[model samples]
Target chain A: AQSVAQPEDQVNVAEGNPLTVKCTYSVSGNPYLFWYVQYPNRGLQFLLKYITGDNLVKGSYGFEAEFNKSQTSFHLKKPSALVSDSALYFCAVENGNKLVFGAGTILRVKS
Target chain B: EAGVVQSPRYKIIEKKQPVAFWCNPISGHNTLYWYLQNLGQGPELLIRYENEEAVDDSQLPKDRFSAERLKGVDSTLKIQPAELGDSAVYLCASSFGSGAYNEQFFGPGTRLTVL
Candidate 1:
């Protein structure tokens, strides 16, 4: 079964600081990794995906993720975090036709 | 293009009561999905539909949970005699196709509270 692990439950960072939310995945074959962000009372918004090629994938809202094959990690990162960027982030791996998701990491950006 | 839409943003029901949630996927989307998200947890797949056909329902609790996407556009998920454990955020998502490369658009979700 394909699965994703987000080690951090919550990450706190000051505004304008760089931020990273770690995620590691396990799959039998090549992994299709994705990142989604959910704001309060809102649906999850797609951030980025790492399907093939390009170790570093850029996504919406000045977000990017590095897909490290040997490390089996797809970590979400931003150069300068915004206070509005605070939300719950989820990492997912495509398993056949379905997607397996991580527990999610809460991002708290303090101004 | 509008995003996926779900109805009844919040609901409070007693255990054993019946509840139903509705969803309307994005226009032109042929694949729809239903997912359950518990507190502090990620969304889990409950059922998936491909053009009005249920292609995947392995994770759905068929004993009490049921869902249908008619006309391959709108969907409804129902729970008969709901259990306390069934309290969670029910999310609806849709994509142009059911492939790994296709990105899914999600709805705001319906939060169900089974007392």
Candidate 2:
């Protein structure tokens, strides 16, 4: 079965500081990874995805993720965090047409 | 372009009561999905529709949960005799096609609370 794991339950970072949310996956074949952000009371918003070519994929809200094949990890990163950037981040893997998601990591950006 | 739309943004029902949520996917989207998201957890696929056909429903709890996407444009998910465990955000998503890499657009989920 294809699955995703987000190691951290929560990540706290100060405003303007860099942030990273770790994600790893286990799949039978090559993986198609995605990152989504959910704000309070809202559905998830797509951030970025790593499908085929680029190992380093850039996404919305100044976010990027590096897909490491060896480690089976795709960690979301941002150069500078904004208070508005705080939200629940989810990493997902595509298995066929279904997407298996991670538990999610709550990102808190303190000003 | 309008995104996926879900009705009854919030609902509170007593345990064992019945509830239903509705969703309308984006125009021209042929694939629709229903997901259940528990608190502090990621969304889990409950059902998926390709056009008017239910292509995937393995994860859906057939005993208490039922869903339909008639005409392949709008869908509805219903839970009969709802339980407290069923209280969660029900998300609806749609994509242009039923491909592995097609990006899905999600709606602001319907939050359900079973008292």
Candidate 3:
């Protein structure tokens, strides 16, 4: 079955340090990967997407993700973490008409 | 363009009571989706609509959950005789099309609490 996996349940990082949220996927065809962030009491906000071309995709809130074909991973990254960037992040892979999302990873950036 | 709109940011009800959540997709968007999100989990697609036709609903619990996208615009998701397990955030999202390239925009969602 097609699925997305966020290996980490929660990742804690210092505010000024670089952070990485790992994600891997198992899909049939070419993968269409995406990242979304959800804040407390709010709906998910689109972060970035990897449809075709360009392994490095940048998105809102200074976030970027590197899409690796051989590794089957699309890991979210930020050069410098901010306290405000702490939230629940989800990795999703498009499966035909539906999107299969990972369980989600809680990112906590402590100042 | 205005983002997808959902009504009743929060709702509380007894387990056996019925509840409905409304969603208005972004103007001109031909596809709408309803998702169920549990605490500490990602949103799961409950149903998907292409225009007024339900293209996919395999994940929806037909015994208690039903959804309609009449007129190919606004949508309504209803749960009759709700159960405690049904307590969750009902999220509405829309995109111009259902293709992989189309990014979905989400609404604030309706948080339902079953007592």
Candidate 4:
């Protein structure tokens, strides 16, 4: 079955340090990978996506992700963590007409 | 664009009661979706619509949940005889089309609580 996995339930990083949220997916064909962030009491906000071409895709709030086809991984990364970046992040893969999502990873950036 | 819109940000009711949630996708978006999200978990797709047709609804619990997109513009999801286990956040999202590259835009969502 097609699915996405976020191994870490939560990740902690000190402010100004780089952070990484790991994600891996399994699908039949090419995967359309995406990253989304959800704040407390709010709906999900689109972060970035990897459709084709460049492996490194930049998005809102200084977030970027690297898509590895061989590894079947699309890990979200930020060069510098901010306290405001603390929130729930989700990784999703679009297959055909439906989107399969990973459980979620909570990122905590301490000041 | 106005982005996706959902009504009744919060609702509380007893089990077995009927409830409905409404959603209006961004103008000109041909694809719409309904998702169920439990606390601390990622959202799961309940149904997906292409224009006025429901191309995918296999994830939806037909016994209690039903959805309709009459004109391919606005949509309504109904749950009859809701169970306590059904308490969750119902999210609505839309995109330009069902293409793999098109990004989906989400709404604030309706938080349901079953007593």
DockQ each: 0.85, 0.86, 0.75, 0.76
Point out the higher-scoring one by DockQ: 1 or 3. 1
**Model 2 alpha-carbon drift over 4 Å, by segment:** none
Tell me the tens digit of each residue's lDDT in model 2 across A20-40.
Answer: 999999998899999999998
* Docking level of model 2: high
Model 3: native contacts recovered, as a fraction: 0.67
Candidate 4: interface RMSD in Å? 1.3
For each prediction in turn, the share of the native Cα contacts (below 8 Å between chains A and B) that it retains comes to 0.80, 0.90, 0.67, 0.73
Q: How do the residues B13-93 of candidate 2 rate in per-residue lDDT, one tens digit apiece?
A: 999999999999999999999999998899999999999999999999999999998888999999999999998999999
lDDT of 2: 0.95
Question: Cα lDDT of model 4 overall?
Answer: 0.93
Error of 2 at B10 (Å): 0.9
Report every candidate's CA lDDT.
Answer: 0.95, 0.95, 0.93, 0.93
DockQ-based CAPRI category assigned to the predicted complex of candidate 3: medium
lDDT of 3: 0.93
Q: Which one is best on TM-score?
A: 1
How well is each residue in A7-34 modelled by candidate 1, as lDDT tens digits? 9999999999999999999888999999
Tell how far residue A100 is off in model 3, in angstroms: 0.7
